[model samples]
Target: MDLEKPPAQQPPDGCLVVAIRVPVRIVMLVVVLPVRMAWDALVVAGRFLDDAVLRPVGRGLLWFGRAVFVWPFVALWRWVLVPAGRALAWLGHVLVAVPCGWLYRYVLTPIGHAIAWVGRGIAAGLAWVYARVLTPVGHGIMWLLKGLGAVLAAGGVGVAWLVRYLLVVPATWLYEWLLAPVGRALVWCVNGLVWAVRMIVTGIGTALYWTCRILFVLPALALWRWLLVPVGHALAVVGREIGAALGHAWRVAGHISRAVGRFLATLFRWIFVEPVRWAYARVLTPVGHAVRDAVLRPVGEALRAAGRATRQALASARDSARQARADFRRMLFGEPRQPRATVRREPAAADTRTLGSSTTALTKD
Candidate 1:
């Protein structure tokens, strides 16, 4: 009945060993199988995500990245890459600045000083060479100028002497000879002209005297006798007629003078007394009074009114100015116009004196 006592109940260690083996195998199978299945499922799921969603998203992301990063790459090329390259190039120059400054200070400065010294030596040498080379030339030029001046002076003197000898002496002799003959000929011509003039004057005087005697004296005597008789008779008639005409003209002139004097007296009396007196009584005095009353009186009244208005306006302006000045004083001093108590903080005499002087000047003004 006990199933042969279950092989007499195996040892606990053997039973525990058997039980551990089965459990280990079961555990391995259960854990390993499910983990493998789960791994396979995860792989499948990852493939599915990649094929369905991740691949498209990755493509889109890559496209978007290209689109977005392209401009950035261009910007980087322009801003960073180009600038970095330029900076790298300029770095060489910037790096050289300190050394260059140092070289210039320490090495180049000395070299420049040496060059200046050498230039001075060269300049001195050139000066010496120029002195050596130009000394002869200067002397030669001076000698040439001296020789030329001497030649010119001598030529001028010789020419003057030659001209005096050849031209002046000959011209003097020729002039004397020619002028002497011409003077003699001119004297002969003058004497002949004088003799001819005397002859002609004598002939004309004789002929004129004869003609005057024949023409003037005989005709005058005959004409005087012929005219004297007629003239005596005519003068007698003219004297009688003239006396009669003069008497008539004197009577007519006396009549005209009386008439003109009477007319002038009447005209003077009428114009001076009657017309002027009438006009003065009727028009002039009354017009003078009317003009004075109408025009001058009104003008005087208007002027007085304007003067009063102007005085009022000036007074108002003065009051407004006084008010504005008061307001300005209040704004500036933060007080009304009343004597303020002087607070002496340090008792500076100069400040007090200045303030007192200003206040006295304002009060006086």
Candidate 2:
């Protein structure tokens, strides 16, 4: 199975892009080479400065800052602030926390309980009054209001009957007999007038719309279609080509700069790094190996031998001292007694059982 993906095909470039690309690349090369070189130079100088000067200075500054600022603050926090904080915590626990806890437990709690009991008693009294006294009073008042409402409702019905016959019935008859036909005729005439006015207004509006279209909108549309669109399209094409050319030029300039950088690096290696490497490999390595063999190795071997002899002497002295201490103890307290081994009650090896023999009472052999 072929797991590799096929390469994507790029679209073909237009003649405008092709024509602009070379000149833009040339110009970009001229412009970018100096800038790239200056940037590389600054980078090299920065690295060299950091390695040779800045690192040591920064380390010194760090030590100074630690000594002057950090260490003092750390010591103050450790020795002074921590102790002060502990003392303040103890004081607060004794003076504020203990007192507050006592007040809450012994004073406030009992007071709150008493207040709650009193409030409950007052609430109970109020509830008793409401249930016993106010409830019956409210019920009686509501009954009386209901009876009054019934009587007032009967009177309202009588007044409603009188109003219907004296005012409402006459007004209804007048409206039906006298006013209805006149209102209907007036409504018909008004509807006709409104329709005629609407038709006139609609015609006027349609004429105005057509006039506006001819005077303003059509010419503006024609100008946009015939003149502005083509000009805009051309400008867009030119802008696109310029932008593409700039991008292509920038990429080409980058490639050229990279090649220049590599060439310079190679040149530097040839001029400086190669000779140093050669000197270290061809000249210094043999000299260093000779010096090690002639001077360092023998000195190291002599030092090791001396160290072994000293260790042997120290061991023998330590053994002697230990033996003397043991003799001194023997002189003072006599020799230590040796431990005795216990005797075994089993039979000797000749009486032992073999694989073909049995020693049991039932199968003795």
Top lDDT prediction, candidate number: 2
Question: Candidate 1: lDDT of 211?
Answer: 97
Q: Which ten residues in a row have the lowest lDDT in candidate 2?
A: 353-362
For residues 1-365, what per-residue lDDT tens digits would candidate 1 score against the true structure?
Answer: 56554456643544534444554444445445544545555766799899999999999999999889887899899999999999987997779887898889999999999999999999999999889998878999999999999989988998999999999999999879998889999999999999999999999999999899889987887777788767876665455445544544445444554566567668987989778888998989899889999999999999999999999999999999999999998898897568879976554666554544544456545
In model 2, the Cα lDDT at residue 229 comes to 100
Clashes of each: 0, 0
| Best-performing candidate as measured by TM-score | 2
TM-score of 1: 0.25
Q: What is the lDDT of residue 299 in candidate 1?
A: 98
lDDT per residue (tens digit) for residues 63-133 in model 2: 99999999999999999999999999999999999999999999999999999999999999999999999
Q: How accurate is candidate 1 locally (lDDT)?
A: 0.78
